[model samples]
Target: MGTPVLFIHGLWLHASSWEPWVTRFQDEGYDAQAVGWPGDHDTVEESRRDPEAIADHGIDDVVEHVAGVIRGLPELPILVGHSFGGMIAQRLLGQDCARAAIAIDAAQIKGVLPLPLSALRATLPVFKNPANKHRAVSLTAEQFRFAFGNAVSEEESDQLFERWTIPAPGRPLFEAAAANFNPHSPAKVNTANQARGPLLLIASGKDHTVPETVTRATLKQYRHSEAVTDLETFPDRGHSLTIDSGWAEVADTCLKWLRGQSL
Candidate 1:
């Protein structure tokens, strides 16, 4: 049988964001599981009303949560994550918790350079208000469109906003911004480990949060895994690549890459 796949989602999104990809992977003979971030609600609307439930969740908490889930699996799963979820996946890999990992539009870990303007713009809202650091905040339709669905059509973007966007924990964002400067920050993942299994970094060309340059720059830190490191780029995809119109293509590409690995 093919290896089990564990999916982790980014901030403001639930595990349901991976439903389509889970189906695709299952069809390819893989067992797939989608895990929610700590305090993630069952629905976007529900999460919107009780945003506080997700407000205090931090990087360390999320990493421990995902690790707990991984411990229950029969074998090490192929880990797939997006944005903040990608950051957590890297932490899991550094802890020797996964068989392989694919980070799509991943957030910046320690030692990654070249922060993009788009990333700053996307994060400006969180930094604008100090209270946002301890509170969860939901985006308006226009805000979500600009930050996440810019590459998709108006109708599709609207639909996606209605279905997926939620009040995300601001603490993680605050922590991520300050990670490089903080010596004791848990937001930093160890990428120098040579035995962390195969790591693939996928960057979306149109992604505003994690641009191509930033993603490529982050890969350079894994010098220990020179032969195992891989990078792939998908043009015309924004930050919401997994839930966008052409998500199947992205999932298919990831499935193929995972299939080629030793796991």
Candidate 2:
């Protein structure tokens, strides 16, 4: 049987966003599927039409939801996640849920130090509003441009925002922000677990939401683990690296890395 690959989408994106990558992986002989965030809309248009459908959910909800999907799979899949999904991947890995995992511009997990100014600015819309803790939040085109399309052109940024952006639950953002302070925070990951398997943290050099320093911090925290944890940088890329025109490059890089690991 072919190796399994599970794709997890980040905030504001549906599983459909990974369609191209799924196709690419299938052609390369991997059994791949894109799993949605719990309560996520079935389509981007549906999400745009009624963003409230995905409201009020938090990090723990998503982490367990995806873990259930992975547990039912025939084999321990190679997990790939973006943004918040990346955090979920790491969480799953912490529990030894996958054979290997890749986190692309992953949202900050507990222990990732010194949150960058760009990440704070990128998340201001949600964090600034206390009410957002229980609500979903949408980004304006300008905000999306600043956060996800900074490395792309103005025209391209507008187009990308129009096509891909959607409202996202703000609860996870709140939980992640308060994780370090709360010992029982759901945002925590078991980075010290040797059984967590191999991990690759991919950072977008130009990403405003998950800067290189953030990924570097995560890499440092994972260094004590017996499992292999490595970092890779894709310069000139933004947080939208997985959905941008150069997405194939990211996919190919992942494929190459997986092959090297014999996964």
Candidate 3:
């Protein structure tokens, strides 16, 4: 069988958000599947209609859920994750769950510092309300435009928001925010495992949620490991790097890297 590539999406997007990616990867001989967080609806419309279905899920919950998905695969697949999904990919890599992995505009895991002002502003929707930690949060169109659509045109921003955005659990955000301070935080990843396989961290130059500085800090932490870790930046992109019009550029970059690994 060909190598499987599992796509994991970040907050505000359902598993269906990865459908186009799945098709692209399949064309390249990858058995790609997009996995969802536990309790996530199958579609964005369902998620938006009943947002509370995803309430109170923490980082650990999602980590375990994705781990379960990996366990069911025939072979250890190439894990590709976006935003919070990127963080999950790193966690799974630490567990030796995949052949290789890619994290795009990923949220910071434990020990990564240098929080940029833009990242803070982008996530303010959840952090601004402490109660959101126990609830599901939905981004306003304006918030989405600023955070995920800043580099795109206004019309494209609105279209993306309407098509892909959905409610996301806030507990994971809270857990990540406290990861540095908490000794036993669930957001921790084993960055020193040589057997964790290759990893590529992709950063969007215009991403407010995860700036290039943040991804650079993450790469620095991985440098301590014997594992092959790499970083790439896509200029003029935002948090919507995987879904925007220029998504193929990012996808092609990842494909080139994966081809080099001979996976």
Count the clashes in each prediction. Answer: 0, 0, 0
Best by TM-score: 3
Give stretches of model 1 more than 4 Å off: none
Which tens-of-lDDT digit does each residue in 168-244 have in candidate 1? 88889888888889988877777778777888899989988888887888888887664477898998889889899
Where in model 2 is the C-alpha error above 4 Å? none
The best-first sequence of candidates by lDDT reads 3, 2, 1
List per-prediction Cα lDDT, in the order shown: 0.85, 0.89, 0.91
Model 3: residues with Cα > 4 Å off, grouped in runs:
none
Which candidate, 1 or 3, has the higher lDDT? 3
Model number with the top lDDT: 3
What are the clashing pairs of model 2? none
lDDT of 2: 0.89
Candidate 2 vs. true structure, TM-score: 0.97
| Per-prediction TM-score | 0.96, 0.97, 0.98
Q: Give lDDT tens digits, candidate 2, residues 138-233.
A: 999899988998998888888888887778999999998998999988879899998777899999999999998888888888877878897889
RMSD of each: 1.3, 1.1, 0.8
